[model samples]
Target: MESKKKEKKALGLAELVAIALGGMVGGGIFTILGVSVSIIGFMTPVAILIGGVFALLAAYSYVKLGVYYKDEGATYSFYKRTYPKIPFLSSMIGWFVIFGYISTIALYAFTFSSYMISGSDLAESIWARKLIAIGVIAVFALINAWSVNGMGKTEDFLVYTKLLILAAIAFIFFQNGTMPVSEFFGKLQVDWEQSHVMSILIVSSLTFVAYEGFQLVINGVNEMSQPEKKIPGAIYIAVFLVILIYVVISFAAMLAIPSEEIIAKKEFSLAAGAGKIIGIWGTRLVIVGAVLATSSAISGTLFGSSRQMAVIAGDGFFPRILARRKNGIPRIGIITMAVTASTLILVGGLELILEFGSVTFLVVSLLMAIANFQIRKQTNSSTILTLLAILCLATGTVLIFYYEYTHQWEQLLFIVFIYVILTVFSWFFSIREKRRLHREEFPK
Candidate 1:
């Protein structure tokens, strides 16, 4: 194994706050709100609140683990430090997630471009999406590669502007929202009683992914200040804020536009919903905000993906070429992630990416919670928290699998393919490292 040593970048609570807020404020709110309102109607707000609660629970689990480990790889490094076998699993999971998020970033960029063109005949061209997406990726890649501070500053800017716009939008609807208490109760009835409840849970689980971005910060645990205190604080704050934002946006859309129209064109639904409420000018404002939000998301994840690869390299599980840090940046890893992301954009798909990541986040969350169980030997508080974390995770997992069974085989296969590749690479790294270590202890 080749070793390349480097210092970890220093980040504080402000940085963590930006990353937490930026991660969740992306395409989901701009896109998912309208569709969710159509499916769940007045109950959309209730569903967002429920999702927020679970996200907060997961955030706390990561906080405990991050504080205890004080390692660069977040859960990957935290679990590795706790048990030797953890690295193999962590590395595979980390790699899988890097690809998943990269794909999502591309998906958002594509969506942004599509919306930009929809309102203007002059902007309409196949090249517009391709050109805009590449530009979005390039701009963020530069921000992330410059330094942690550069990336953090960009994210902080994105977070503030995005929140202000969303808050303004929410307030507008506060004055204009239409679902009264009686009307809400009346519309809450969705055909069959028992079947709708079951269907609601399944669909709601899918919607929950949009709100899981708060947990995205867990990957950068070692990068934050007072991570023990701040990381969890940021997660709780971000989730509550996100859910409230979503609910308000849902209320606004439903008040200003018909839910049925939004449902019919769910893919391009948000722009229409926005235009109806705020006019053509308003739609453009939302699209600009959406682009910035996703650009910030890509910047944060680009940093995270590089860090994950760096951890894998440092562990002697991957080519140490990626382990080298130049001026506080992992250049090779960032480039690799960027190139992979661009190729994913070319592939032009997000369903596969979402399905692949959906199941694995549970695995990561469950493990992080379980870590609380191991460290409990050191402190009973850890045990109690881990128990609570596990309870939430178990329920989320059950809901996820239930959706898997009912949804489609294609979704199931997408997840299975990632697992298979991850297992194969895990073995490849394990065998190569075993040989390298033996040579180090007892020279040729």
Candidate 2:
């Protein structure tokens, strides 16, 4: 009885919000800062704001579906339950979404390692970075495998601490910035000559992945109390906070660092900016904040996505072994995710991993919006908002592919190949499950 009570108290509104923030704050802002600045210059904050709007659109559907269904399976389960006739759709989402989470794990781990070695003598050693990335994933996997309560408490500390650190970094940048706020805004007008509307939209589309983890709040529905209320509450609050954080940080970086430097040191732009303005201590501060941010992201992703993976496996859409759980946690799923993400870190470069993740979640969120649109009445969702969500996400999806097609056709091809492979696997599993059900119903 006492154990049950303790378990119930493991995650509350604060912890739920922390998980969502942890997931969203990870490698997202850090990864996209230089890229956004490069593409839009002083208008990078505007692009981030637009990106946040799209995220809010995507969140609307997710929140509505989460409230209606309240399932821990989240994206996969919501779609499956909404459209029972097309089990393949659900299976495909499960596979694609899990891989999306894998891409993020790779993104966060890679970002963590990059910042970890930024000031060190081994900063340029690719092998050392990869090794550290793998090591961090392994460490977090063990932490997650140990206990849910422990993961939540650790996430709470990391997420909130990083928030404070990020705020401080922003404050320092604003205080000691090379560029004035008035000049920053003026550049938006004068710099318009250098950037086009299409470029800004493309940057905004890519920023979608930075907001990817808010849905993780839903994945913890079963662990939390009054999930219907908490899911939407935590997710909305987290997204709002993340948007503010990203926009402020982007604005600060632009003010403190030159666009050329930002583009050059794309991976560690914040740290580089801090070093220039506030010295080595400032750089070290940003790095520490980034490490904590990415660490919590890894921990939260492993916790939420592993459970979603286990739920999908239990539905027989994935290998049954993935469904195995210990101490109410999906041990096998957590380790498998860690290993796959590490392999991705080794094989894929930073930009490739970031783009793949952005595309995956954009596609997945678009699908969720479509699903929500179909059952708008049931979920008490506005038809106009749902339809608009679909349109916005669809446009974002097309913009990403367009950006990649023009810039990196090879990466786009790789993303397509991955989708084709996941589709095939989803089809095979769906058919097998269907056949088994058929046989059981009409017994030979």
Candidate 3:
């Protein structure tokens, strides 16, 4: 093991809740909101609500497992309990959980740079934007590297600020937007007013991903004070809060701007939409909020990714160095995650990365939900909830792949290609590990 370091103290329920909130309140809200609304128009809120239901179902699966396992595996943990023999595949899927967050962090860095450059009218300076993004990543990593407590406080404070800003956006939207509630409600179905059902579903699934933030809470089970009871409560609260905030914020953004404007800009593109209602300074303020929301999302994701890596390495699957902790921080894992995410950034275009990432993440969640159903047969938690999680995950998976086929086959295949490559590499690692063990035993 790297440095033979011991596991750090368990994180408290509040800290875990903050982690969950930070993940759910991630960088996407400000950026994707504009995109979803612009494409689907006012019906964006309905779409989010639809996504929210699935989120809650997924949350219940984790909530149930979190109370029991209180381990770091998240989805993989449940699977490990079932299929102990082929844990490599389970772990590979667990890697997707990390991949989703790490990629999102990269998105945050890029988005933050975009806003800083846009707000400063320096969008043309590519070098400066890249430098600033690196700086943002360094700043957050350094903070968490110093103290986990600092991350907890940072997320808590950011959560409140983020929520208040969202509330303010709703107020600005209600006061000045010309779009009627009737018009908003009418946009619910696929029609000429918006796009086709496939377009709406793709956007909805993308929007559904915004709800992926609840997965952040899984890590909290290990961190919570009264994990058995408190962690589940926190999950419900965070999921509910995420749903409410997203619904309100999306409604306002769509009302204030045309659907076309929203799709082009996405999430924090709310600044411009809000600007139409509250003026330039008001929009600028929202930009500042977007920076916080997006950056905090990165910080939370970094922390979660690091923790997952440390746990994985400790299990003897990965290089022992990844388990090393300095000042209670897995610096190696953090660096590795940062490097991995930045590498993905070279792919460019937020929508593509997030879309592909969502597919992988949703599949993992489906696996986790299914695991929960199997576990419930062996445990005592509500069978109803486990069944609900299964149904929700199934619906999401069907919609996700359906949207994939219904849109562009090549793009979807490209994502499947990435997963296949990773699986192949995982197989190689397993075979090599087995050979090394055999050599150690016989000294041949």
- Over 4 Å off in model 1, which ranges? 1-10, 34-39, 122-127, 178-181, 189-196, 215-224, 377-385
For candidate 2, give the lDDT of residue 395: 93
The CA lDDT of each predicted structure is 0.68, 0.90, 0.71
- For model 3, residues 1-444, the per-residue Cα lDDT tens digits are 533222243466666666777777766677667666655665667777777887787777777777778776566666667677786776676566666677678777887887876856687887677677777887888777777667777877877787787687778887777888787666655443556765556566676667676666665344445567776877798889888888887776667777787777665467877777778977887877777777767887787778777776665556779989876678888888877776666556555667767887777777877777777755565788778777767777787788678766877887778677777765665666667777989895
lDDT, candidate 1, residue 381?
46
Return the TM-score for each candidate structure.
0.89, 0.97, 0.89
Q: RMSD to the native, candidate 3?
A: 3.6
lDDT of 2 by residue, 91-155 (tens): 99999999889988988888898888876899899999999999999999999999889899999
Top model number, TM-score:
2
Question: Candidate 1 — number of clashing residue pairs?
Answer: 0
Best by lDDT: 2
Error of 3 at 112 (Å): 1.5
Runs in model 2 lying further than 4 Å from the true structure: none
Judge candidate 2 at residue 177 and give its lDDT: 84
